[model samples]
Each structure stands twice: as structure tokens, then as C-alpha cells.
Target: MNTRELETVWAPRMLSVLRIVTALIFLAHGSQKLLGFPASDGMPDPFTMGWIAGVLELFGGALLVAGLFTRPVAFVLSGQMAVAYFIAHLPQSFFPALNGGDAAILYCFVFLYLVFAGPGPWSVDATRRQRSA
Candidate 1:
């Protein structure tokens, strides 16, 4: 149809797709660190910051996938990404590419955007809003 109609109808659905895909990718990072399913160099010790990050990535990614409490979850994840970038990546070099912190920066902004966007359509949050109305 028209561009306006396409945007109106597809954008929210695309947001859901984005959320799901991002969560899956993010979860894999956690799985690598915590579960070691895909196998990594090493697993982080329990309760260490690395392990803690793994916990957040695994659980937070799941929550985002489900779009449950999307705003709050996204807020925490955004903060985590920001902290990760500064703590792990900033020291190596000024440029994100050199430091390999580009993903962190992208995740930070994307999660921050989700904090405002409210997970869009096809989300538990949307369903909850619908039922409550």
C-alpha cells in the first residue's frame, strides 16, 4: 500500500522482530559466558562481575524477547551496556572499532531506545495494556 500505511502497520511489527532478534543474539553472549553451550575460552567464576554480566544478559535478554516489563528491563540493559563499554572497552583505545566496543555502544542505544519505545506490537506489554484497557 501507500508508504504511510506501510509505516503505520509494519513499524510496530518490525520493532517486535528487532526485539526478538536482538534478544536472541544477546542471550547467546550470556550462554557463552554462563552455560558455555557454544563454548568459549572460559566461563566466568560465579558472582564475579563477568558472571554477573552473564546473568544480566541471559535473563534480561529473555525478558526483552518476551517484551515483559520492556521499559524497565531495557533501562537496566542499557545501563549495563554503557558500563560494559566504559569498563571493558574504553581503556583499550579511543575508537570503538579499535577497542571492539562498537557492539556495546549499539546495544546501549538500542536498549535505551526500547526503554522509550515500549516494545512496540506483538509484546506481552502490549497485550497487558490491551487487557487492562
Candidate 2:
């Protein structure tokens, strides 16, 4: 196919892939903190910032993966990532690399993009729109 055609055909599919993969990775962070499944040092204490972040990451990531309520969920998750970077990483160093917050920064922008992008064409949101129209 031509370049334009390829882009047209694959762009939405790629967006869904991006959403799923990113959510899977983000979910792992929550699992580590909450369930200790990948076995971090230990689970965070209940209702602490770390534990709260884990809760959001776990549930928000799941919602994002399904593309359910994608825009609002992405907004909240994006905000969470931003707060995580500032609170956890910025104090350590000015540079994201040095602070180990590069992933947080990336996730922040990506989720923000999803907020604007409307979960592409492979989401429950998309299906709902299609049905309602």
C-alpha cells in the first residue's frame, strides 16, 4: 500500500496497541506495589501515597486497557504520573534521567495524548459511539 494508505489503515490499530501495551506495563507497577507479585521490597502500607498510587495504577490501567471511559481515566492517570514525577523524582534531581522519572514523564504525556485522541478506533468508547450514532 501507499504510505498514506498505510498510515490511514494502521494508525488507529497502532493506537490501540499502544494503549494496551502501556496499560500492561503500568499495571505491573501497581501489581508490584499492591500484590508484590513481581516481588518488590514489600507492599506499600495501606492508604499511603504509594498504596494510593498503586490503586489508581491498577484500576486506571485496567480501564485504559479496555478503553472504557478512556478520556477521563486518561486525564486522571496523566495527572497521577505528573504528580509522581514531581513528588518522587523532582526532589532527587532536576534531570529526569538522574531522578529515574523518565518513564513517569512519558506516561504522563502518553495518557494526556490519549485524553485528546479518544482511545482511537479499537475501544469500547468507540463502539459505544458507533452504537449511539
lDDT of every predicted structure (CA atoms): 0.94, 0.93
Residue 102 lDDT in candidate 2: 98
Alpha-carbon runs more than 4 Å astray in model 2: none
Tens digits of per-residue lDDT for model 2 on 20-105?
89998998999899999788999989999999999999999999899999999999999999999999999999999899999999
Residue range 64-133, candidate 1, lDDT tens digits:
9999999999999999999999999999999999999999999999999999888988989999999999
Clashing residue pairs, candidate 1? none
Clashing pairs in 2: none
Q: Lowest-lDDT window of 10 residues in candidate 1? A: 114-123
lDDT of 1 at 58: 94
